[model samples]
Target: MSKLDKTNEHEEHTPSSSFSREIEKEPGGADIQHCIQCGMCTASCMVASVTEKYRPRKLIQKILLGMREEVLTSELPWLCMTCRQCEERCQEDVSLAEIFHAVRNIAAREGYIPVGVQKVVDTVMEDGWMLKDGYSDFIEDDRDDLGLHTDLGWNNEFVKKIKKRFIDGGNKK
Candidate 1:
């Protein structure tokens, strides 16, 4: 057999153990196994409409095939805007948004967070809530003039507790 022929063999790829099942155990991921690769979800996806790289059906296929590492490390899962357009069009009732979120949970725990997501997490950790990265020094002067706290009134203690309970506990998100 030619080397290319060997590489193309269907049997060369072995599905990992229960990668789909792992997602199924996650919230909103239970219906993943029922996906029939109908492509309806992809047809209805707005993200897929706008971007060539984001394909919902393909992601499901990879998960069902147990391409665990590829799925987890991919930025495609995070590209979903959770608009539910795909979910509405899905005949199998697969909750693609939820399934992707579940994948994100697993990916985050594995420290595979995308840069944009990590920035939000970092902001929440620093200020006890989300603040724009451009929150300027001049805002302090304005707050002082208005007799308001320069450090917005967000509860730092709550953020800290949440981080300790979630991220530090090995279930990082």
Candidate 2:
């Protein structure tokens, strides 16, 4: 191969370190540099098996390649199930859950949250949790079919204290 051609190929594949560095600063993402791309994480990832777009190894590659905007702006980071299957099988002991969580934190702080994630956050902020406020109609029917009690013995005082400590504290009006 010509010298010019070789130089061009080298320039094209140069490793961009900024994004990886930024991720390393987050709480659980410090272990990202240890990943060896051995594919064990991918092989053990339940999300990767079912979803064509949610490959954990590929996500790490993106960050390592300094694809900062692409990593933060995409819905791919939000697809982690946090099952820790990949972490368990990792050769490098990298915590995929922590990395994903850190990515999600960055994404949220950057206002890049997907619609479904925003809805869950809104639910948690408003109701102190998701299921309690959403478990009336369809959930009750399922519970009845299974011979379970449909009446929700909810604790309003607990909810009130949580709202005071967090939800109410945040609101200006």
Candidate number achieving the greatest TM-score relative to the actual structure: 2
| Candidate 2 residue 21 C-alpha distance from true site, Å | 0.7
The per-prediction CA RMSD against the true structure, in angstroms, equals: 13.3, 11.2
For model 2, where is the 10-residue window of minimal lDDT? Answer: 7-16
- Candidate 1: which stretches are off by over 4 Å? 1-17, 128-173
- Per-residue alpha-carbon lDDT of candidate 2 for residues 6-121, written as tens digits (9 for 90 to 100): 43232222343788888889988877877767788888888889987788898998998889999999999898889999877775667889998999899889899999889988
TM-score for each candidate, following the candidate numbering: 0.66, 0.69
| Top of the candidates by lDDT | 1
- Candidate 1 lDDT tens digits, 1-106: 6433543232212233499989989887867877778899989998999998999999999998889999999999999999999877776567899999999999
What count of clashes does model 2 give? 0
